[model samples]
Target chain A: MAQEERRILVAVDEGEESLHALSWCLENLVLQNSKDTLILLYVKPPRVVYSTFDGTGYLFSSDITAAMERYGQEVADVVLEKAKKLCNNIEKVINMVENGDPRDVICEMVQKLGADVLVMGSHGYGLIKRAFLGSVSNHCAQNAKCPVLIVKKPKPANGNQ
Target chain B: MAQEERRILVAVDEGEESLHALSWCLENLVLQNSKDTLILLYVKPPRVVYSTFDGTGYLFSSDITAAMERYGQEVADVVLEKAKKLCNNIEKVINMVENGDPRDVICEMVQKLGADVLVMGSHGYGLIKRAFLGSVSNHCAQNAKCPVLIVKKPKPANGNQ
Candidate 1:
């Protein structure tokens, strides 16, 4: 039987965890399949709307906001560049950058692009911290339309191992 | 760099959803790798303790209890048999049957066997239903040491598609 080409969407970020996931996917899933498309997605945080006055009663300047946006773009570029190097052997690679919350953007893109699988990296945050700050991977796993693969970074080798 | 042989543990059950996940794994992950080990795990519900006298004032016979155990084994056999057929092309396949809660069992096995990837099927229950009856896949995805892949069965294609 002929195999259908698959679109594997991988969410990348500035963190090492996401980069690790991309490498793992490339090694395990992408290296063997020349037909599959590897989509590297980086979601920038939504642009902040600034009022005239800041919380500290300081004047909010447009320059500050613009600088922040530029920084976000640079970070996205660095992440996508690192991910691309890992996919050097892959034939079809698509780089995408969307500005929004990572969780929502990932879920939406998976459905819109008809992705066969969504690969993400676990932050490995503690329970308390995860509750205070929402986990993007966990949220995407619950809400995404396609299969979700959460790749965990293995712990450093202990003497026992 | 040569890739390391990976142990892929797939959690199977009597439900069609799990069988579908096994099929997906075979097509996507197992076919290309001859050295990778495919572990097919089927977790049976823990045996119930039967009292001599029932709450309804009926006596529970040993025969009835034995028959229930037999039925459970039969179901596990049927599921394993069907899964085996799907895995006929694969060279290394290991069948495992354990009795316990599936969520706990799967998480424990992944760690004990040092599985590289754990594949499971999403029941795809709605939010409310998922809340009432806890989702096994969700629990394992959060707790398992290895990467967890939750394969969701694709919805029936509509005429427009």
Candidate 2:
């Protein structure tokens, strides 16, 4: 039987863990097949803090929001640039950035794109920390229709693949 | 440098999800290099009924404990046997079984073994179900020192990899 094309959606963030997962995907998940596509998804979280000026309570400023948006864009570009350098075939890569909660945005995009596999990196958060902060990869694993692959970067001693 | 011998630990259980992960490891993680090793870990939950029985009027029976142990062993063998068949090179595979909470046991074993990467299969349980029952893979991802890989089986339309 002919090999069907595969869509591998990788969740990208500013952390090293996400970059490790992206590298691993490039090395292992990106098939030699021409049809295979690697999607780099970077979800920019909604703003959490608003500037209050002149004793005004909870007033949002357009300037601050614009700056935040610019920061998000810079982050997306840096990570995507790093990912592209790691890939042998950069043309097969698709970069996507969206503003929302990462947990929901990732699941939604995976379904919308009909992704075959959702690749993620373990943030290396301790149990207690994860319990408090929650984990986007963990959430996607439970909710995404397709299978989720969470990749951890090898320890320093182990050396990279 | 010659490919350093790599230890890829896979968590196994009596579920299709685990077997799917084992298959995925064989096809993707297990390179042609003879130095690569695959470790299959099966964590059997501690007997919950025994503690309940001891508290209640009903006395714990040795017979029941023996039966439970036997069942656990049977499950371990079945999953490992299935995993072994999936591998092209069986000599590099190792099978281990432990009795404890799966979430704790899996993380402990991954560290104790100094595994390079820990591979697991997501149970495909929904968010609500996972919140009630808890998830082992999610726990391991958060706590394990090494990298964790959770493989999800492809959807029917996409066809299996």
Candidate 3:
């Protein structure tokens, strides 16, 4: 008989915060003897650079393109690194990068992978962009088929709990 | 005039799902625009339901007793129901249900109340209960604050945009 594994799909971004959220989800949802999937999501927002691609705006250029790729790779690396250290069973995890809106990708991936839940940081690299787009996290929560765990960034260390 | 306020607080309970989640928060968070205090909280596990007689348990019993008393009064229709309804602005939101555990309380409340930035839901409820006490929500997203919404229930009937 297959084990009743809880599929906790963690969504990591470009900072320590998303890792922290994934850590929480791992601890809370993925119990001992349960299967867990920690998916690292490094989403590169759609960039419309006025490049010479068909003489229209396509996201490919010298610095902007390189910088975007660099940032995307960095995000994936950092998030996965921190997450690996934070997770319990490393064998049940996977990490990768995607290009598009975080919310849409998150929802799509959740459906595609049959993710039971989504774990994410509340505030991430694209706060301004999210606000402009009416909140990426909000869109994900409203649209995603699975449950989402929203983690708040910890305050600068002080007496705050 | 109201400082362009934007926040939504939701009290979550896992069993409820949907309208009890982000939808509830979104519905009520937008209730007062800038003045809204979006608080998404899952009340911690109710301290062991000690009877109303001994020690620290007395304090909690008093609160429950008060709630029960009010419930009774409303049932009898002796007191003006509208008075209680009109006096508390917090009670106006839909899809919020009070649960025995603090975790459920915070999440459902926040979802129903619709706060802008969630004040406390994950750690406060989970950490407070501890492993022995069995607080589940504690393991949720730990960095979700602003634009962070909660959902104790499932999605609404009309579907989210």
Q: Score the docking of each candidate (DockQ).
A: 0.44, 0.39, 0.10
Clashing pairs for predicted structure model 1, backbone only? none
Among all candidates shown, the one with the greatest DockQ: 1
Query: What would the per-residue lDDT of candidate 1 be over residues B67-146, giving only the tens digit for each residue?
Result: 87897799789988998898888788999999876778889999899998999888622232234447888788878998
Among these predicted structures, which one has the highest lDDT? Answer: 1
Backbone clashes for every candidate come to 0, 2, 52
- Estimate, for each residue in A69-145, the C-alpha lDDT of model 2 and write its tens digit: 78768977887777667665645778898877677888999999988778887762223323434777778877887
Question: Which residue runs of candidate 2 sit more than 4 Å off their true CA positions?
Answer: A1-4, A31-35, A48-57, A88-91, A124-133, A152-161, B1-4, B32-34, B49-57, B88-91, B124-133, B153-161
| Tens-place lDDT digits, model 2, residues B1-161 | 12568788888877777888877677555666458778888876777733443566665588878887787688778877887777756468888888877788888988899887788888622233234448877788778877677777666776764
Candidate 1 chain B worst ten-residue window by lDDT? B124-133
CAPRI verdict on model 2? acceptable
True contacts kept of each: 0.46, 0.48, 0.19
| Deviation in Å, model 2, residue A100 alpha carbon | 1.8
lDDT of 2 at A54: 30
- Estimate, for each residue in B74-94, the C-alpha lDDT of model 3 and write its tens digit: 422322232223224543333
The weakest ten consecutive residues by lDDT in model 1 chain A span A124-133
lDDT for A122 (candidate 3): 66
- State iRMS for model 1: 2.9
